[model samples]
Target: MNARLPERQASRALLIGSSRFSHEGLHDLPATVNNVRALADALTDPALGGLDPSGCRVLTDPTTPQQVGDAIDGVVNEALDTLLVYYSGHGMLNQRGELFLAVETTDPDPRRVHYFGVPMGWLRSALADSPARNRILILDCCFSGHATQAMSGTAPAVSGNLDIHGTYTLASAPAHETAVAPVGAQFTAFTGELLRTLRQGVPDGGELLTLGDIYPALTRALLASGMPRPQRLGTGMADHIALARNRAYRPATPSTVKPRTVSEPRGTTITPGVRSTNEQDPKVAAEFHAAMLDGYRRAKKELNYNAGNFIQMVQQVGGLEAARRLLRASSVSSGFTTLWEKGRLDLAVEAVVLQDRFAGLFSDEELDIARDRLAEYGYSPAQTS
Candidate 1:
């Protein structure tokens, strides 16, 4: 079941690509061109699963920077519910810390170069002018630091310190480093990872992947790919901001499966009649249990709670199962109760996995109690006899 937020309207995105430039001077121009087209193709491709191409409006291979700016102007002017601007090309930084797109101009002098690219200042201003509540800007080009530098001063102006409501800028690399492109690939490593995660969909508490869920996955995937880690500029609260504004973003939600229950006896301390067994590392199980308790406490205080958050914390402690039961136990909206119940057995397995981790941390009696509680919830421990 797709979790529905307050808003039900489909979201709109604007994809802009500048591959063939009028200017012949920039290095790696061909790669930049290809990457943008590749990114557009990825977004439009149905195989990616989550993102629907019907929601996106793409503009590729703009010959001039003005054409790029014009494309953005048209999208923002429409005042769509959600606006995403993606640019892959050359970026330049001036002495004043201003970032510009390398645009086409007759003058070629490096000192007085007419930066043909759209100004970071103008992009931000355009977002400000738009009626859309969520504005996302992704830049995959060289010398992109200026983009962040331009938006730094405005970060504080956003509500709740979240960047998603305003103009959120994601750069391919830091200011000092150069963005890299692989042969035949259209996008840089960082952009590719970002697209992959967004397309793959994140695992939210139970099959519901939110914008927040995708961010970490994207970050981890990019780093794991052994590519240049893109620098995320602007406020770090983009996802939160987007959610707060009720924008249309897709979430990945997994199907529910029934849980199998198992029971055992207490042998050593508690009741002298408990035995437990499971396939999990004892130390990891203990840590997973501790993390769940800690996360529960934190969630209660924040009043900003979700079963997925707890599930994620538990998984971090051990594995997927451990997180599932904690999620079932936690208070969820009525719509999600059936999902939790169906997956109860899987959650039990997770608890057992965590119990194994806790074995070494607690005394025999404590272990028995933990094991019993898990059993009470339908998780069967490994056979000791």
Candidate 2:
């Protein structure tokens, strides 16, 4: 059994939205504005009392680059437990592979325009200097991948760096792709789906769900909704960071967490040597057991049943236990039983079948034990004919 770890403290988030323009004349920034509002709503929503929005803050306006920089610096300097940075606007890249966030003052002039967006290198520095255990950087603007590329290329390798222990960065599109916002949508498809998943809650093994479990679900949902695959820019550390930071952000009604099952076809017969298990679906499980029994019958009739094939089917359906019984009953080398036990169920089944076929082995006592086990597991061992 796995031991439980100590619970970490809650996280803090910093949201920056730049919709108004100071120089490049308002670029019709509805998406960014809406994203800011939506996030604010979710945090302040009484339903999210667990999140504790009092510590969170949002900054958006026609500010100078210095003001934007100061806001980021102030938040990181506080050294909060978890720091989440969300930016919704434009992103650009220079010939040097450097990335920038386009702020209000960013010049549109192709030759002389200066990009005011946040530099990923600078962001990494802030995270590295902060005391926060986990850091999440989410960019919803165009050219999101560029930031990831910049960080991966230039960020320091120190363990305490925000880019190390608990750092996660998610981009909406590939490095060169454009991020499109559907009409009437509050945010881009990726962001929308992410919020929806978080709001609905992530699914875990049973009723308990965590942020780690939600990432894959969100990825699938985004793909199903026609959004491009969001790039995962970190390692296991990224998952740890997101989970530790988002623990305070839980959903009210968690999604279902049922395990998957395989089924069998209809009209199959079973035999005494046939074995099955409760691990799989009833019908499919029965079908697999029936196939194993049929194989033995065929070998008895034609004197040429492929033991290898029978073992394979059993392994695919039941597991090592079933395969061992088959091998022992077939009078195959019992010496291989220990080896098969150590192998994967499928592999063990294959080994048993191969041994049975080449050695022409039979274990009557073992077969009888298998048949009894099948009956105990609720499988029918009698053939219809």
> Using TM-score as the measure, which candidate wins?
2
Q: Evaluate candidate 2 by giving its C-alpha RMSD to the native, one decimal.
A: 14.7
What's the lDDT for residue 266 in model 1? 35
Residues 184-248 of candidate 1 have per-residue lDDT tens digits of 76556766676665455543222433344444455556656775556554342243322221112
Point out the worst 10-residue segment of candidate 1 by lDDT. Answer: 330-339
lDDT (Cα atoms) of all candidates against the true structure: 0.50, 0.51
RMSD of each: 11.4, 14.7
Cα lDDT for residue 89, candidate 2: 73
Q: Per-residue alpha-carbon lDDT of model 2 for 158-192, expressed as tens digits?
A: 22323366566777777777665786767767777
Q: List TM-scores for all candidates, in order.
A: 0.55, 0.57
